[model samples]
Target: MNKATYQQQFTTEDSPGWLAIDDQLDQIYGDTEPRHYPPLCGLHYAAGGSDPIDGASIYDSNHQEFHRHIVSYGLSELYYDEEKAGGEFSKWGFELTFRLLPFQDDQHDPIWAIQIMNNLARYVFTSGKWFEENHFVPANGPIRLDTETEITGFVFALDPELGKIQTPHGEVSFLQMVGITNTEVEKLKQNPTTDAVKELIDHLKKDNPLLITDLNRK
Candidate 1:
């Protein structure tokens, strides 16, 4: 479809890209809708108003361990013809996803992951740096503030299940966040190669395919 046609035929049901993302989540959760969160104060670029993208959180128990999966909208071409829609990579080419292990009795969804997503978005907008598979970045401290957890950095990887989808805009990949400790980050820096990061992730996935960030790992 051309840009004008795409713009005219863009309802949520008719939205190929956006609906595909929702459908992927639906297949996994089966009739369960995620708890969607919109930012309280708008992101810096939105002129202190409403947020451009919405965050969705879903609790998954089927995996060997239970964790909350948070997904971000708006990183890519969520709406039809919002921008040119033909390229190998979608608008930003990827959406940010985070999987966090939850406390057994915890009832409320953790909002920290949403904050991290927004911060990453801000960095992209300001710095023009895009994160891709096998890229590692330092969190500078515990991923969770004021906590003593050893996880101090994050590595990106294609989500095992929600790998990639062809959208009206192009191709979008779901880049998941896997936390690592200072020691692991240093080891990765010494090598500075994609294989080095992949090896570390491969080791982590052996125990947990979802690659849940283990704050207690030594």
Candidate 2:
């Protein structure tokens, strides 16, 4: 179909990119329902709120390890738009994904991770810079504010499972967040190379494929 014709018929219901991402999540969750959290006020660019995106949390429990997976819904062209639709890469090219180790007795997904994702979204929206694989950023303090967690920063990596997908908007990459301690963050700041981040992730993956953020890492 011609671009004009396609855009005319496009509606939020016809958001292929959004649907494709949900489908991928459905495949992973199967019959389980993920806990979804939409921004209470609205997106930052529009409403000037703290959170600029929607978040969904899913729990994965197996013999090997158990963790909570959180994914964001803003970072890309989520809906159908002629002007921003169809390109070599999705809106900003990637969506943020995070895996956190869940406490055995935990009853609900940690809201802190969602806040972290929103802050990152704020940085991108305000700075016009996008995050990519191997890119790292300092949290400036404890990743979980007011908490004594050793995780002080994060690095981006292609999600080992979700990886990337072709959407109507373009190529969307699932950039997973890997927590890094103060020492590791310093190493990344000093080197700032893709290989340096890769090595750190490789070391992390030796324990878990999801690369769950270990807050207590010393």
Candidate 3:
């Protein structure tokens, strides 16, 4: 949006950025009430809770196959701050996303993915670091503790379906975190470049366009 239009629109709205995000999700999910996890108090992270992300929304997706699609809020300027009107990018310019293959246990949900996003958000908020497309992070152990899985790390890419959107606050990219094996992490470390990571993602995308994180994959 243009400078004048953006200012006129967002200035009056209580949470234009938040609404914009919801609208984008609406296009895809269409009234599907996602399983949302928010803090007990207001602005959980700011109010001193473990989750830095304001909220985490998980939806059952069947784009390529059955999976859980998780998206994070609060990584960007979710609420209206008059001072931050229409810049090049949002707060961190991106929100974390994760696509995981459905777990076996029907009794439990995939809250672990939410925790991982919060941990990453904490790192960004505390250390002033940010992630971009094709970035990789090591988990030190299996991504899901106590689980026998080869996925020990993560590599980020633009969420295949969500991609990116322009909000009244700024632009936000849905950066999806895909699970990877320790072996893949080692390969990324050897090169440490965006292209190298892209090469890895491209190969994975051939069969899995959405790059869903299958914990059982070796």
Ranking the candidates on TM-score from highest down gives: 3, 2, 1
Task: Give the winner by lDDT: 1 or 2.
Answer: 2
Positional deviation of residue 152's Cα in model 1 after best superposition, in angstroms: 0.3
Error of 2 at 168 (Å): 0.6
State residue 124's C-alpha deviation in candidate 1, in Å: 0.9
Per-prediction RMSD in angstroms?
2.8, 2.6, 2.0
lDDT of each: 0.76, 0.78, 0.86
CA deviation > 4 Å runs, candidate 1:
1-16, 42-47, 50-52, 104-107
Candidate 2 lDDT, tens digit per residue, 1-218?
Answer: 33566577677568766787888777777777777778846554456666777554555634246677888887877777776665778788888888877743346778778888888988898899999998888888988777767789998999877889887778889999899999998888999888888888888888877787867668
Ten contiguous residues with the weakest lDDT in model 3: 39-48
lDDT of 3 by residue, 95-213 (tens): 98999987674346688888899889989999998999989888999999888889999999999988899887689999999999989988888897889999999999999999999
RMSD of 2: 2.6
Question: Alpha-carbon error at 37 in model 1, in Å?
Answer: 0.6
